[model samples]
Target: MTPRPRKQVLLRLDPAVYDALARWAGEELRSANAQIEFLLRRALGEAGRLPGAAGPLPRRGRPPKNPGGDTPADE
Candidate 1:
């Protein structure tokens, strides 16, 4: 199935806040944008405001090279 298209938003933050968020994101190995989304999701879940249809966050890294479980020699 085709994935839904993501929405874009324009956000404004104080320089100090942005720097702190960037540092936290770097420590967690996520982009600042992803870190923001993660925090939002966590906040929603904690407040019982998350939607039932909300999907899990996207996978973080590259897909497996041999997804079909085929040996390289077989190819």
Candidate 2:
């Protein structure tokens, strides 16, 4: 038998807060859950806490060139 998918947990918030979240979610064309997830990701990304998150890194010279030798440096 296949394992069942994990269940999602629901959070209860103050009515006013929930209403605000709902309105923000509607404005962004996302469900409350999706809006929360997006907010969490953005927060983590800003804090450099997300796994495999892209941020500024030390420059390692120019990026690799494509297979063709048509790169500007080749000119």
Candidate 3:
């Protein structure tokens, strides 16, 4: 099935807060936007407000190679 488009949001944060978030994200190797989403999801889950149908976070980085050691570029 085709994946749905992700929603875009505009957020405003204090410089100090943003800096802290950016640093935390960097430590975790995640983007600021991703870090925000992760925290939001965690909070929602803890509060039992997360939708049952909510999908998991999308995978990051390169896709896995085939067992035959072939990739799309090799095809």
Task: Give TM-scores for every candidate, taking all chains together and pairing residue i with residue i.
Answer: 0.83, 0.56, 0.81
Question: Where is model 2 poorest over a 10-residue stretch in terms of lDDT?
Answer: 53-62
Q: RMSD in angstroms, candidate 1?
A: 2.2
Task: Report the Cα lDDT for residue 19, model 2.
Answer: 93
Q: Report the C-alpha lDDT of model 1 over 1-75, residue by residue, as the tens digit.
A: 566788899999999999999999999999999999999999999999999988889878787688667676566
lDDT of 2 by residue, 3-47 (tens): 345448888889999899999989977777777777877898899
| C-alpha lDDT (0 to 100) for residue 34 of candidate 2 | 72
- For TM-score, the strongest prediction is 1
Model 3, residue 51: what's the lDDT? Answer: 98
How many clashes show up per model?
A: 0, 0, 0
Q: Which model, 2 or 3, shows the larger TM-score?
A: 3
Measured with C-alpha atoms, the lDDT of residue 30 in candidate 1 is 93
Clash count for candidate 3 is: 0
| Candidate 1 colliding pairs | none
lDDT of each: 0.91, 0.70, 0.88
